[model samples]
Target: MITENTIAAISTPLGRGGIAVIRVSGKDAIAIAERVFRSSHGGEVRKFPSHTVHHGLVVAPNSQEPLDEVMLTVFRAPNSYTGEDVVEISCHGGVFVSQKVLEAVLEAGARLADPGEFTKRAFLNGKIDLVQAEAVADLIQASTERSHQEAFQQLRGGLSDQINAVRNSLVDMLALMELELDFSQEDVEFLDRQEIEERLRRSIEELDKLIASYQRGRFLREGAKITIVGRPNVGKSSLLNALLGMERAIVDETPGTTRDAIETQLDIKGVLFRVIDTAGLRQAKNRIEKKGIAITEFHIEDADVVLFLLDASEGVTRADEKIWQQVERLSQKRREMFPAKIIIVGNKIDLGNQLTKGSFDPEMGKWPLVLVSAKTLTGIPQLNETIFKAVFDERWERGDAVITNVRHLQALQKARQHLGFALETLKQGLSTEFAVVDIKGALEQLGAIVGQTTPEEVLDRIFEQFCIGK
Candidate 1:
């Protein structure tokens, strides 16, 4: 194994707490920790058994003064996180205590670890692959249970095993085909043309499915945008406040209380949404309200899912009809630009004898409608559940592999496209040399997913996102 210099860092978050951990890893990790550490037994710490903890005091090398009392744990090489000698010191949790201990370790001959160096060493030493390494960061940053579950699964080699299996199959087939090309003089059939074509088609279909999952995965990682649009005094602010479960917007018994677009995050079924309560849509008399209206329109145009709030108590007035027309025109334009999906929300359902069922129609079939009272929260749960089902849950199979990273998904898609070209080449009876080139190209793309043939800069950029302790 390649040996590296010792690295040290404060592994815990910076704050005042009961305890903090300092991590050290490399060839000299234990030795470095031994120099500044004195066991309560007053014996040589290097003689201590591996994977055991001992009480000790960190002392200054020069003055022999106690820096801080600590509990030290040691792990020997080939069994630790980085496949190297490792040591962890649990000291009193304080800014000064951590800094003093770190300084003493540095004085005793250990350099501070860079961001993500520990995980980088894990990857370089074969403890994990690139996908698993990336998942460590994702798991740390995951905001919901579902995202945490996905990240943890990926970290345990779920994604790596899937990609590597496909790559191994392609490599085996390519090697057989190449061997046949080398022995053109004899009639040795290494790969049957029809059978190889069938295998390629099947692999391409599987890759397409994985690639398509990225759409839902991206939204799961990054919150979806849900813009609330309606005329003045339609309880838009009230709805926003209710969804957030906090008083993030000003809600009063007056028109246009919310004169600006207020945004907050909401979690539904472990999926996040960037909910924006825009100023109620209406003709404005003042400069500030006009600017707010302009901003609201802008948000509506850019939303991933627009929640067009209609005043159910008003029974769809002429102004409400105008708003629906505007939404319809925007929807049609959006459909042409991209696949735009929206939800229609009817508010103030608690008020009796208003907005009878099927009273107004936007004429666009399948426009989902929900009755809600943002004040009483009578239908908020139903509305929240419906929105989650419509936008977030694409019903991906439980055990089916899905590529969540955009970079990996793009590479897989390009690989699938090359597989298509390879299929066409084989059907045309092109030279075996030309066919091999396309197959190799596809193989390279597959390799990029697991870092088999990825660039050094790509590796650096990926690992840099991780925290030093990880």
Candidate 2:
């Protein structure tokens, strides 16, 4: 579909830089750009070949006064990002120059592009699908190499291909079911019950796999939360600094230096981890101390991996045992809801004559333990590896389609539920018409993932997360 009005935006981030890019798209993009941009060689911008770049100067429309020297790139209709005539002006990086250039384009008849309008136009014009459109935003916001790779794969249509494959299977089954419905009076069985059940089972299995990937996918997209919990002066803050390669938390000989939770992000082997250093766990000497300890416990509960540090030089004290008891109680209560893994870290091994490997109770139930010296950075690499493995123990291979978006996951879950209902109906020997209802419901849910039947409000919400220039 061709957009009627031209739109313009500063594609590059707003600020002073070597160069800033202003993008214009739609039917009148070329005409609008030609009116405000004067070529260095006195050539017309409209006559430039598609995908060609020319030296130019942006000038005010009425005054014809030079605003800034620029490099103009032309992309003609059916070949541009939005499948429309598009022009990009590379101007001097000054904020005023770029704004004035954008103003010139606006004054020449191009409207300001809204948040994600360029990408939205791509979707509407069939240049990309809904999933790929969202991937554009994901690619922009990706923080780690792993997330960037995932977003790149999605933008290249990996996830969309998987969803389309499953949807095609459902469409085929729906066709056969509809055929059965058309001949209901003839008592003709278009497809055997066994075959129908088998197809439904396979579809459900595919949906189930996508649904199961949400946890790891979410962790990959938004870094896993790792919280450090231990008694005072157990090197919790030191560990945080060592992992981040910077002093993110205050380190001192004094106990309870960290009176609140200090959170920072770290990238390990392409995966992002949010490391949180919390106040030491101990009996409250006063109301403020009690609040800090309470906050520490709360972080422990919500963490993806709880690093329970023990001072190797001091050995496990009675106070340490009490804290372990508290951790155990909380773990037992929320075992099903919050499945955060507990890793026992023995710190300060550089002090020498530290606790032996078997010093802790074997009853701790096989929690992974690593000995480290935070001051000397000894065994720190092993500690990092242990932390990553504790959270992502599943066998995941690259290039596999994973569901990182919560909306997609929810849709897959609903699709699985509907498939389950259809299977149950088939097993109960119900009418084919009854089974058709559940199958169609599953199809609709899957369609929503690709924006085939999604509500307009959902699209707005999803694109609103993107920056205005996207």
Candidate 3:
């Protein structure tokens, strides 16, 4: 338990409301509150029972001048967040009032809490592990219902339990191997080589599954970046405005009107997509247009999905053919990295023409194509539905155990690599001692994901992402 000093902060967000909570924790939390709090119900705050609330008046410690009518609640050490004596002062929700009460608490001998200090104390004092500590921030910043559900599950120890289960098995195997070394002279075999190999292989498969799931997890957490690219005056901006259901981008019939990328976020069926409408992919005479094309290229390369727009009325021109060839060549280079999905969209369908059957050759793989007229607001809903289906397949599960944290993903990847080394070593008929080293290293990497073997710096960085007063 952390019992050395008290930490305090205004817990509620800045702005006016019915009330705001100022939280304090540490060994001296109660004492610090009592020094500046005066009771309205004629009971001493310092003498109040733990986990109970009392109406009170906040006053200056030296003069006893009442500042605000308040309610003070107390939690004894080892039972509260941070495992220390904690106090929550309920004051008027006015911004100035909350700030004044917090300042008073600090004046009465409590230090200001840093960003995520309360949660950090909880982690340091063993209330929660590092994975749960990170979940606190994730839970707050979650933008979608699916994200919130996933983060809450992780906060409840879903990931930790899975990691610890694997680590415990590896530790047992290592202990048995070490025991064999101790009794080698006496010819006692504490562990069977074939059985150990089987167990390790199972762990490796499980870890591999987790690492593979990160592709979906990362997209869910960060949202998909979708860039719309096409030649000049192909209604790229109109398509963007149509998708967002707003006039977020300027549109004109003249070519080269869009000279920069316009980005907007949309929640399509609870999945966030950062859609960027870039300058049309065309040869530029103006310096500004050339720069915009460069930026468009940059967004295309970094996008998680590309909406390649084609002018259905004009047909595929030489420039359009060139862009399509470039996309085809680029897809080959990214085959190993799980590259973004591309959709071939034919826009301006309302230009007094009907798109016939077999508009584009399907022989060159199933390039998803959708015909839409941005001017008439036609086919937008279907376009969005297509986007969702293309991104999240039927196998995608929400609230399933997924690793969203990058550090955890990297650690899992390293652990998988180590497990591969162990398997290779065993296959080469190497000594059990060498194989054990690789096995133990893999276990340690997995342990770090759950805070069992994490470094101090990693903990510091994770907690630092939390907002102050969290």
Candidate 4:
């Protein structure tokens, strides 16, 4: 709930740093900060103009005992972060000292803020819409340059403007239909059925484009998962180290050296992929090796892409064929839910030049193949390019606003469904009232995306994902 009480919290990350900040906001933010602060310039904080910073000492409210030397910045109401009076105290960056400063502010008069309360206030106060509010969280969690660009674009109203425009067009159409119904006794039509159907078709097409971008957006927002699987001693661990350019995995010439999955992140052209190196997939010789293979299968089931590694010098062994068969069965099981893309990787090509074209041709079906030597770093660049192309399609080259949030995607899906039903109704030459019902349903879903008609519990769930003090 949006409260009238002044709020105080430690806004900076809790760690040893050069500086840390405690933020206070509400109507009495200035007066509450003034109670414990004494300016080095010999003036009251309440009298200072907005956007001014002052050197000060944080003192006890009762005894005025100095606690720490600090800098206090003030922002007046209607322009502050929460659209209320805000005061931020920059104190010495010790965990204990920052705590004492915040304790003094709360002792004077301020409630401890809930997680995301500041940003929630901004949304309720109309400083920004819900889409922009979610973008604030995404901006903080962005892992790659591409993800950062998409989040910042949404925060700047690139996505919000389009959503609002769509909503307004539907609202205008709804008003015309309702107005025509009100004057129906005179037997007049305000809008043609053909025109409404055409408008709806355009809106549905727009939503389809937005929905199609989720694959790329999902990769940018949540990094892609690429799991590497192969038989024992097939250079899985070596490939992991080569791709990350570090000794992330333990590599040994002996088989079964790795007994679990080793996961690391790789950034390829601004796209992040979580690369996992798994234990050898074969008939386990021991209980421990069997458990390791089980974990490998679990990751393969959930992976967006699987790199099935094989020893190129050996040229398609029986064990490699067995693992491929298992992967095919798993693909059939998960075809409807996150079907993993399997790429056949032939490793140790530096031993010979036989695999110049990445082909076991008829030996391995129609799967994409790449040849590399993880020991010598041969063909690593081509392997990276292959992984990128295997997941991202041509839809990623467009410049439209992407749908990154799951909430936004769900809303878009529902709105598109309603619009679809309405369009079908209009094409069937039904009454405007029947199509109007679905159009209003579509409008409500679109409103929820921008927080116009969102419920209280939904707002709570959204803001709960943020850290306290925002």
TM-score (all chains, Cα) for each model: 0.92, 0.95, 0.95, 0.94
lDDT at 104, model 3: 91
Tens digits of per-residue lDDT for model 1, 1-470: 53568889999998899998999989888788878999998867688778999998998766778989899998887888888889999999999999899888888889988889888888888888888888888888889877777788888888888788778888888898899989878978888899889888887887877787776666666767788888888889899988877788888879888888988899988888889999887889999999998898778776778888888877778887788777766644643423446677889888853664467673733667888999888889988987787665457754555566888987998899889998999999986667778889988998888878889899999887778767
Q: Model 4, 1-470: lDDT tens per residue?
A: 23578998999999899988999989889899889999998999889889999998999787888999999999997888888889999999988999998899988989999899889888988888999999999999998988899899988888889888888989998999999988889988988888888889889988887877776778889988999988899899999999998999999999999998988999998889999999998889889998998998888887888898888887776677788787766644653634778788889988864443444535355677888999899989999999988778855663568888788889999999999999988888888889889999999998999899999899999998998888
lDDT winner:
2
- In candidate 1, the residue pairs with backbone N, CA or C atoms under 3 Å apart (3 or more residues apart, or in different chains) clash, namely none
Worst 10 residues of 4 by lDDT: 354-363
lDDT of residue 310 for candidate 4: 82
* Tens digit per residue, CA lDDT, model 2, 1-470: 88788999999988889999999999999899999999999999889999999997899999999999999999998999999999999999978899999999999999999899888888888899888998898889899998999889999999899889989998998898899889989988878989999999998888877787776777888889888988999999999999888888999999989999999998988999999899998888999999998888888777888888899888878888888887765544554633888888889988864565566666453788888989999989999999889867558777888888889988998989998999999999998788889888998998898878888898888877878767
Model 4, stretches more than 4 Å misplaced? 335-338, 353-365
Each candidate's lDDT (Cα)?
A: 0.82, 0.88, 0.84, 0.87
* Higher-ranked by lDDT: 3 or 4: 4
Give the higher-TM-score candidate: 1 or 3.
Answer: 3
Worst 10 residues of 2 by lDDT: 329-338
User: On a 0 to 100 scale, what is the lDDT of residue 392 in model 4?
Assistant: 83
| Candidate 3 C-alpha lDDT tens digits along 1-470 | 56577889988899999999999998888888889888887887788998998888998777777889999999997888778889999999999989989989999999998899999999889999888888888888889877777789889998888888888888888899888988888989987778888988999988977887776677667787888988889999999889888899988889988888988898888878899998987778888888998898888777777888888787666788777666555544443656778887888888744343355545323667788899888888888988888777678676567888789999999998888888888778887889888988998899788787889888788888898887
For candidate 1, the per-residue lDDT at 67 reads 88
Any idea what lDDT model 3 has?
A: 0.84
Models ranked on lDDT:
2, 4, 3, 1
Cα RMSD for candidate 1? 2.6
Task: Judge candidate 3 at residue 429 and give its lDDT.
Answer: 83
